[model samples]
Target chain A: MSDSSSSFISNQVSDISPVQSSTTQSQRRGSSADQDDVILSIRSLCKSYFDAEILQDINLEINSGDFLVLVGPSGCGKSTLLSCIGGLTDVTSGEIFCRGKNITQLDPAKRDIAMVFQSYALFPNMTVAQNIGFGLEVRKVPAAERKQKIQQVAEILHLQPLLDRTPAQLSGGQRQRVAMGRALVRDPTLFLFDEPLSNLDAKLRLSMRTEIKHLHQRLGGTMVYVTHDQVEAMTLASKIMVLNQGRIQQFGSPEEVYKRPANTFVAEFMGSPAMNLIRAKVIVEAGAVKIQIHREDRAPLVFIEQAATDALRAFNNQSVIIGLRPESISDVAARDPQRSHSAECRIEYIEGIGSDVYATLKLGGSDVISRLHGDSNVSAGDRQQLHFDLSNISYFDPSSQLRI
Target chain B: MHSTIKRPRHLSCLLYASLTLLAFFVLAPVLWLLLMSLSSPTDLTKVPLQWIPSQWDFSRYALLLDWQNGSGKRFLAAMLNSLIIATSASFIALVAGVLAAYAFSRRNASMLLMFAFLATIMMPPITYILPLYSAFSELGILNTKVSLIICYSAMLIPFAIWLMKTNIDVLPEEIEHAAMIEGAGTIYTLRKVVLPIILPAIGATAMLSFLTAWDEFFYALIFSSDLSAKTIPVAIADFSAGRVTDFGVIASVGVLASVPPVLIALFFQRFIVSGLVGGSVKG
Candidate 1:
């Protein structure tokens, strides 16, 4: 059943134009060199609980050896999408392809996938070794191989010394490792992790995140991890799928998603302290395109960026949201005036974060934050000249929220 | 500070005096029964109200044990019958109740089935006595151990399920899901994951079931007409009502009947308290 659907998608891939085909081929090669071949393809997935839609049409493809992350806000459907792939949840309408076959209707066990839950659901009655061997035992793997494999997995997870200990005897982090080892020994086609480190302390979470990345690289197994933590998504995923309100906001390589967000939501959702969004209106005057930003209690200003102007030619007089990362804005007082784009604003609050300073400035009828070096002279309630890099600004249509 | 603390101490003495008087009012009848069991048979109805036995005779205990002289039944045999009935009934009830509790805990079973079972506990046990008695008699099990076990198990399952269901609900569903993802089926997860966490509640339920079986007197008296099925409680009651009541033997049997439950509590006191508290406090 899955074979037919996979063949159908492959057939679809074969019918594209040469330009698209080559681009896709290059893209595939880029991922294939790192990850295994394609193992799971989620197409047009939609789910609604009762009548409230929790996931919209989600389209994602998981290759054989890739660390894919589904990340978003609490109710953005990232966990729902991950659960759908693992068959822990049912999709309202979609097809899930596993190993070149359709497995949307298959039970979780039959899907041949291993998942580590966020809670690290170790069977409290079983020892660490027993928990690790449970999956293999269920599949009727011979007892000897199961034992040997469990031992090997325990060693890999550094749980060999604790093999005789039940989950009740272990700490939270130890139990988490046992949960991972349980999935690890399965050696299945895919691994699903649902915020596995969320229950750990900050130090352990960082270490575990590094370990997961290393393990993925070493095994080169196909993995789909779900987390709301952006740092984990950035560090662990080769491809990140950003979701918002049951819809995919953006799906691309981590760098691509970070550098070229598809919309304001993706841009703001990905960065720490978030990207500052300013409301502005595009205007055309004397055959020149510019933006007029009006801030209450401040003088109005006109700004022009050639790229933004050209891209928004037909969007004159339309309100647009401007996206700027904190680091892209700096204090004009310290930075070379000739090397920076300048804007005038009142300083609202200044926060120092070790190596840099973040000053929240009122500008363009909204608040924009600037990241300055450690010696920045800006202080709270002080009028300041802030410089925003024109080349790094992202413009989004106010209504559609699509990037221009 | 000492003087301030003494004010509550004085108040407590007054409260203690009143509560002690109330306790004596409630316990006076029990004290009278104890005195009656120790006094001579003629002294039982004496108008002088003899609180102490003058002869200090132990012949009643000997006669009650012989049954040939007391109630035409053996105390040892009745004691054995009670043990078998209570243990078997509680054990069977636990098995059935755990299975049904697990089913109700995980799935959304019909309200009608749950309520129908619960309704049995709400009605007095005598409400079903005639039908149950006729069925047992027709099946030749009216005075058998099997009849008591089946009846006790049926009577206790509703309350057990209700108690266990509450404990099971507080457990995170994720634990079961994780077990399932790890390849455990429903039964394996229940036995390995769910059971251990709720062990306290299971123990508490067993204790409650055993107590219910031990304290039951109506069914034992109505159904058993011979030594083979008569339990300790029935035998004790019968001996006390005879033409010559043996007070010492009744007290000894009463002490014996109380031993098992007291031992069970002593051995599992921690589990019983923890389980009951865990269920109530959700900690």
Candidate 2:
């Protein structure tokens, strides 16, 4: 058991060596050269209302053309953070630098940031063309120039046909497009969106999301998008910052955050159906580690020679949380022989959603769902052997709630 | 389909019946006033009430319009005074009230301050008449159009603020935030966005303020000694006070005085309905 675990660790170390060296080399160069590309930098940002803190110690650096999304549950301060960046809300304490200048005390108008609100905020009294060109008008741009710019933005947003219509006359999606046109016409240093797609129906929301992503690609401007929808963050962001309870849970590329969440909150928050958390005890036996998961009315399943034994050494005989996404577990027939860890459990229920099936099973006295491709042959009350992919499993310290 | 059509016919009959009833009750007074304005002096003094005058005499209207007759001169001066007072007072109140309401709607101003402004509206104007008269006299502006304008504006400003504030509150704050982000200052946002959206409500409020100022008799009666500053309401009241009261002339003055308000209301009827309902619903 010890030999197999050690071999796996050595293989992972070898695999990461080249990538690690390149990353460190880039880090050395990034310190100075990257500073110029940092379009926005927030340092020690804290905001409070009365005695209650709303945001704390928020430090972030957004680079040029980076679409950074602040995502969390309701009341998690994602919108507040976006507001601080846009200079709409004054920070309680902290400095925000935009284009290498501190804009902490600046007015929203002076900040050179455009924002698209959830309500679209298109002036109801103004025509689509007027709404799109309003910022230019405010800047005192000449009428011809403003018209040309509005034309350009309207063309890009496919709003040419609706130019003369007021916001009330346009459909919800059209209104959102006009809002995008308004923001785009400014060509500001940064763009802030506060749950801009929340008001649209699901179908429109999906299309609008794609449209925004395409716009981001075409414009390549720095934008900070705030949303409670993790799917939006996953799809739209170049870097996703997961916030929970006014603090950052994780900030990383989508793959890094999804595959390796920093903590339990992120693990639960980032994925649909969420990561399945199971309480298990670690046991050290003869220089190897085994996980003991106890089940009610059944024999305990002891997983031997887990690959994470070295990291689990200190946690021997102590409770640790095992996080596995639904896709990680599958029926025995569908499991890859070389990559899966098999376990026996009784199927509790089955939920079929079109192309896939989800089997609910009792494992270690907890309900664990296994996602299977096509129809799952397993039925309720059937004792089934489920295979869990070992490589994507996350281990967390129960006390600290941090990933091990 | 047949049942649906039949039901609508029945419902529409009931609707039309109620609407006719409402129209009669509403227009009866105006119709009666019109009849009186056109009645001969002898016809007005008859013991039996005449819904339709046997002889229609428009001489009273002609007398009210002409500046030659003493009563005509007094009526014209009072009408002019009412016009000036209503227009100026309503304008002043609207301008100050819109600015105050915008400020009150913002987060910086405490709710207590809003309530304080609203508290002024809760007090009846009659309660402040004596103090206002003393202040006006002390300022040496009594019996002047400016004094009446000031008094009317002061009386109506609180109401304007309350109505405008509710209407402004219903506007999306995000629109203001969007404007601010677009390099627009507070004043610019108000001018370009806020004002246009709330224009209908402002029109409604202005009409209301103008009518209130135009109809106010208590303050005008106490402050003005003659036709120089007295409004239509006071002038119409004065018509009944002589040894032999001319009911036809008095009714003529009342009808003339009502024309401005009635015309303004008719012209802005659409705005009035929307403005009144605007506060309770989002745009």
Candidate 3:
């Protein structure tokens, strides 16, 4: 399975234009030479609590100015991994290299990192300015310099008016901004965030998400962020690492992870409403690979062409899982024109979410959702012709749950 | 709607009346003690108990405060001893207990370990008083303020730990982690972050520990035989031991002895209430 994925990755790499590939190769060489561009590198990191293993043999390389987001469900070791990098939690095994230095066993303070926590974690006793300047104070930075840097960070975060107010006096959003300001004032090599926006209301979360993205763009500093919210992960991250049960399921660009998830878990976990996993069997017909999807009442023999069919040729006549995102399957008129497989199914439920309409229907004996434009008139109990864009579909081995 | 509003109003009136009656019963003894402290010796000894004495005199209080006399000197020394011992014991207990509770709360110590630490508080203090007395005597520190301070601190440490632990447990652990990431060490984090947030709990614990040491009778009685190391409770007991038992003098001493703790409670009542409620609810 690993061999096949490696080949697949190499093939994808080869498909990139030659000039772009050469530049990436040169950048890789430059990174290897000085190791200046790679801000943090974790090698075979593992953490365990007595008998329970919380993080397993994890490896990651984060580049300078990269917004890397580690996203997973609760207890999936995303936060633990972040803590390990921040030196708040000790790794059971493995090396953590920051700026080419082995810092796995160093003190968190000595690691030259700043972290913002979900609870804001502002010092209730200190005013906003004092909270932001605490790191500078601990570093024995002179009072005059600390004041200037704090003022600058406060101005950037629009926290000048809250300088005299303690954390309890500020609203939740203000506290969160102060937390970010505290981290920003340090000017550390890396910033670690553990669900920093999770405590805010939905509107505030969205705005903060945008603000953090803007901050990343402005500062161009390395960051390792952990969140369970996929939308935040997708919108803010230059790279996304999907984790499950203390193991990294996939690590890639957000588009790569979304379009070609490495496993069934990543496919289901990364998308809201989740990708529909339809049980199907592959069949080689007329020297071309096709899939046989058996429905509940009528078995519609829909043959879809996907680029991965060649790799899945050996699994012909065997049951496999087909992953289709909600947006990939839509009304016929809303589907992409390149390659679409159309089928008629009775819509069981309709959910209008202002901009889009989600219709749940039975496909291949399993419930699959189709996302259509809001103006696309469709209702429950209606026989709708659903067009599934097969170009971006994923195939996985039924037993192993690994993408084929 | 009218009936519902009226019903609550009537219920509140009944509740207030019952609360007032309970307060009167609870305060009656203290009020009597105050009245006794104010009455003249002749008026206090009168039959039917002069609830409101015709003549009030403060001569007993004056005598207690006259440091030139032997009795007044002993009373002043005892009061000073109580102050020193209570303050020292509570200060030591506060320092030791806050550190222990922080470790217990953050380190994820086993349940058995926590229960074992707490087991000391659950056991009766009298059970180990004999051993403690022997140890202090062998150390040649018995009947000294040092012995009483150590004993009182030992007794209060476990209770202080329990209270501080519950308060610290409710504080989000991420705050401490954030401090660490901000280049602050464990001591700095505790002082700047954890200490300030849990200051109320510390205040309440200190007050309670001081009161416990101030009012302790058994340890003070067994440990100190002289006014040099005796506390207020022991002094009050001594006041009742004289031949003919001057009730007026005893009441005066008792009233003075009760003042410090009452003042402390009144001064820090807000912190005490919130700290106790925070502890119990989190537990």
Candidate 2: regions farther than 4 A off: A1-36, A309-311, A332-339, B1-25, B110-113, B124-127, B273-283
Model 2 Cα lDDT, one tens digit per residue, A1-404 = 32343343335334543553344335334333343387899987999999988997777776777788999999999999999988888999999999989999999999999999988888877899999999999989999999999999988989989999888778888988998999999899899999999999999999999999988877777899999999999999877888877777777667667887777888899888888888999999887688888888588877764576567788989999988899988874434456467877787898888678888877666898888776667678888777878678888888767777
On TM-score, the leading prediction is 2
TM-score of each: 0.84, 0.90, 0.88
lDDT of 3 at A323: 96
What DockQ, between 0 and 1, does each candidate earn?
0.32, 0.50, 0.44
Give the candidate number with the greatest DockQ.
Answer: 2
**Which residue segments of model 3 deviate by more than 4 Å?**
A1-36, A295-299, A304-309, A332-338, A341-349, A379-387, B1-17, B108-139, B270-283
Interface RMSD, model 1, angstroms: 4.6
Interface RMSD (Å), each candidate?
Answer: 4.6, 2.9, 4.8
State the lDDT at A265 in candidate 1: 77
Candidate 2 residue-wise lDDT, B117-160, digit = tens = 67876887788888888999899988998888988898888889
lDDT of 1 by residue, A183-271 (tens): 99988889999989998999999999998988887777789999999989999987788888887777767776776677777888898
Q: Which ten residues in a row have the lowest lDDT in candidate 1 chain A?
A: A8-17
TM-score of decoy 3: 0.88
Q: Which whole-number lDDT from 0 to 100 does residue A44 have in model 3?
A: 80
